[model samples]
Target: MATDHDIPSPCPSLRDRKKAATRAAILDHAERLFEERGYDQVTGAEIADAANISVKTLFVYFRSKEDLAFADTWLIDAVVDTLSRRPSGTSHAQAVGEVLNQALRTLNPDSGGLDAFHRGFGESEALRSRLLRMWADYEDAIATVLAREASLPAPDPAIRLAATQLIGIIRSCTSDEVREYVSGFPGEETDALRGWIRQAVEQVDNGLTRFLDRTSQSPGI
Candidate 1:
C-alpha cells in the first residue's frame, strides 16, 4: 500500500555497475603503484596493465595520470553538494562547517592506505601541485554555487572570498590533522577538530561582518 513517492528508485543497471567497478579498480591500482614507487616513477600504461585495462580505456576514465593520482575529486563535489543543500536559514559559513564536521566523522585514522596517500604527496612535487590546483578549482565551484544562492553572477568577488575562506577551514582541518595522524604522532581527535572548525568559521563570519560594518560607517573618501 505504498505510493510511488514511497517506493525506492531502481539501482544502477548492471552495465553501469560494471563500469564503476572498472573505474575503481583502475584508481586502486594506480594509487597502490604510485605509493609503492614514487608518482614520477609510475607510468599510466603500467597502471592500466595492473588494472587489466588498456591504456586507451584508462584514458577514457581519467584525463591524465595526474587525475588518477588524486582520484578524489568526488570529495570536492560532495562538499559542494552539501553546501547547495543546506537549509534556507543557514549561513554559508555554518553550512560549510557542518559539511566538514560530517567529513571528519568519516575519517579512518588507523587506515594504512590513508598513511600511504599522505606519504605519496611528499614524494612528488607534481602530485602536490596537482592537489593545489584541484583545491583551487573546488573553491571556484563552491563560489559559483554560493553566487547562485545569492542571485548574483558567477565569480562575484564577495562570494568567491567567502568560498575561499570556508574552504580554507576545511583544508586546514583535513591536511594538518591527517598528516599528523598519518605520521604516527599524536593528533587531535575528531571532536576536537570539529570544535576548531566551528570556531574558525565563526571568527571568519563575524570578522567579515565587522569589517564591512566599519567600512560602511567610515567617512566617504
Candidate 2:
C-alpha cells in the first residue's frame, strides 16, 4: 500500500492544458500585432482573429483590451511571490535584490514586443495612467508581503514606506529614459544597466537603515 508521502502529484488535465495553450496563443498573437501596429491601432476583434479565437473567447481570458495589452505586467506579482518565499534569515534588501537580479537576467534587449510595449505607453496617455495605477497596486502587494514576513499588521507604516522605496528603486532602474538609452544597445549596455540596478539596490539597503536609525534617535517630545 502506498503511503500519502509516496503518492505522486497529478498533472493538469488535457482540457486544462488546452485552455493554457489557448491563452498563450492569444497573448503571443496580441503582442505581435501590437508591435507591428500601435496599441491604439489594434482592436480586440483583430487580436482575437489573429489568434484564431472568437472575440467572446478573448474576453473570457482578458477583461479589456488594455488588460490584454499589459498582460506581462505580472512581473509585479512575480516579485511579491519571490519576496514571500525568501529564506527566513534573508534581509529585506537581499530578498528584493535577488528577485530583481533574476528579472534582469531574463531581460531580452532584442525582443521587439518589449520595445513596442514601451512605445505603447509613450503613445497613449490612458495607458500611462493605467500603468501608474498598476505600480501603486504592485507597491501595496509588496508591502503586504513584507508585513507578513515581519509579523506586522497590514498597512504597517514602516513596511509600507520600505516597500515604496524599493519599488521606487526598481522603477528608476527601468524608467523610460533608461529604456530609451539601452533598448537598442548591445549586450554591453545591458550589463551596464544590470550594474546600475545592483548599485541602486545597495544604496537603498544602506540608506534605509541610516534613515530609520536617525528617526528612532530623534526626540519625540
Worst 10 residues of 2 by lDDT: 112-121
* Local distance difference test values of all predictions, in order: 0.71, 0.72
- For 1-221, candidate 1 gives per-residue lDDT tens digits of 89999999999999999999999999889878876886788888999999998999999999988888777765677778878897866766787777766665665654332233344534476777887887798888888887777666665556667778877866665475644643453354545556677787897788445322323544431
Q: Which clashing pairs does model 2 show?
A: none
Candidate 1: where is the Cα deviation over 4 Å? 1-17, 36-38, 112-119, 174-192, 210-221
Quick one: best TM-score, which candidate?
2
lDDT of 1 at 159: 62
Clashing pairs in 1: none
* Candidate 1 global lDDT: 0.71
RMSD over all Cα atoms, model 2: 3.9
